[model samples]
Target: MSANTLRAECATPGTQHVETGHRVATRSAVLRYPSLTTTVPKEFVHRASVAEVMLTDWERREDHRFVVTAQWPRSHSFFTTANGCHDPLIAAETLRQAGSLLAHAEYGVPLGHHFLMWDLSLTVLPEHLSVGDAPAALDIDVVCSDIKTRRGSLAGFRYATVMRRAGHVVATGGASFTCVAPHVYQRLRAHRLSGAGAQLPLTAPTAPQDVGRVSPTDVVLSPIGQRDRWQLRVDTRHPVLFEHPVDHIPGMMLLEAARQATVATLGEGVTPLSVIAEFSRYAELDAPCVIEARRLPRTEHEEAVEVTGHQDGEQVVRSTVTAAASAG
Candidate 1:
């Protein structure tokens, strides 16, 4: 069947009559089908492919709730020299997309602006999930709990997300996002609310801790206390810092910035082998920050370093980066 026809059939209601053991009975029920069969729009599909190496299916559970399922295909692009997970941001972005889908489904609106994931804290569970050519599926549940205005006219939502694989918790995290009136969002919101503006109250969190100033050229080249390890820092306002919108600063980009800083700290002529990161909090824009690293104890063949990002006297991100010497 054509995609459109299949979608219509799935959405249409059908009546069914049943006979119980004692007597005949009639009831109305709405048939529900797997969201995978409900193809995602072409634009969204393309966006998903480019944003992350994954595909997602979304189903509306209620006016304010949605279930999003995502599958990440194993490929060379996601592999590392160490042969484990290549990028932690892959999972982080997948979880972000799941939350975005939930918001769209709940509000019956299309995403208007790019999402800025202001904060994320994740722990790699003891159970190692698969990292291979086969596809791995994750079920995500999201909820918006607080709404607030900040940094002038920006409206933000505090979101909580839960991720699962094979009925086991893989990760759970929260984030804050500001909504903008983009063409798609405007059209969807108009259709859903019939042109009436639905205003939700704002709920802003307390101010974050303050770290020291970070300079754009603050490169550590190598950790002061360890060999083959490095540390560095960057101001958020640096030109190279805001180049990629997809990374969403403070979220993925900040992690990359931290990684790059660590590489710089390793000084000249060193290349990274792998990087594993765990986000802890938001790193505000235009704020001064500090990054520190030290060599971790490793085997003869592998080298590792412990890296930390701090802003306002609080630790925002922690990472472990490993690399091999050019000749070794």
Candidate 2:
């Protein structure tokens, strides 16, 4: 195989050869060599809009190891901080896109397959995230491990990433997700496949400053009567969060809710620097999901908050967010 070649084999019985140009997949196998280009296909990242795709290009270094490149604008409409630094969640989004791209473009997972993220974690240095005069070019070194395959198709994998800017380490993160074929996904989401009429009434969000956010539209938690608790607000009309329609709440929205809940619990002047999250099940949009945050035993330099989301008496997401005082 060549440096850019990706080999895929079809093991299913009675399957005939399917050819696309020079590539063919029969009961045997085939090889595909991606052209070297900076433009990443939006479908590889599972994004509806090309503008939302973070990855610019990727190259396989060796088996299970790859290098992915991305570009972060000097200013983003949503992923910015009032403290003049970039939001740490940007790392999370980049990590998510990088993994999805690798799975589809490298591992031979079809484009129509669905991904179920089991867990995600990211840690960033505050000073490293400060917006520079120009857009930041990032190179991410990714190592995929514990790969699972079935019927010669990728089932799932866990990957770790280290992001660098100008040779300086900016962020480190990892995530694990499983892939489901189209038919299996349809069976899994039988009745709730469509997003039509699945959204509930919009509730009023808390003050933007209270949650360390500048825009009310970006806040994902609505204040309730109880302290350290809020209702997860679902805004299907939001341009970025709900870029395209889906039947359930987006994982990024849940992550934002967790960040807001932590900020609210820890008071102002603190910015989240690390986040570790686990998703047990999908958060349906039609039901009310309650978000709660409680302070954990403080460390010397950081404060931790455990944020949980409960829908219909079942926990859907649990995240531990660690924050530190913003750099002056």
Top-scoring candidate (lDDT):
2
Q: What's the distance in Å from true for residue 253, model 2?
A: 0.7
Error of 1 at 296 (Å): 12
Per residue, candidate 1 scores C-alpha lDDT tens digits across 1-328 of: 1123324333324656688988765554355444333334434422523434343466556544556667655542322112354234455556555555544444433444544445554443424454655566777776666755444433556666677778987666666665555654456444433523232222221111111113323221223344433333333333333323321134555555444554454443333544556666555433444566676776776566677777668877777766564344
The regions of model 1 sitting more than 4 angstroms off are 1-55, 76-87, 108-110, 148-154, 182-250, 258-328
Highest TM-score: give the candidate number.
2
Candidate 2 structure quality by residue, lDDT tens digits, 61-88: 9999999989887777778855677778
Clashes of 2: 0
Candidate 1 residue 312 C-alpha distance from true site, Å: 14
Residue pair clashes in candidate 2? none
TM-score, candidate number 1: 0.49
Per-candidate TM-score against the hidden true structure: 0.49, 0.87
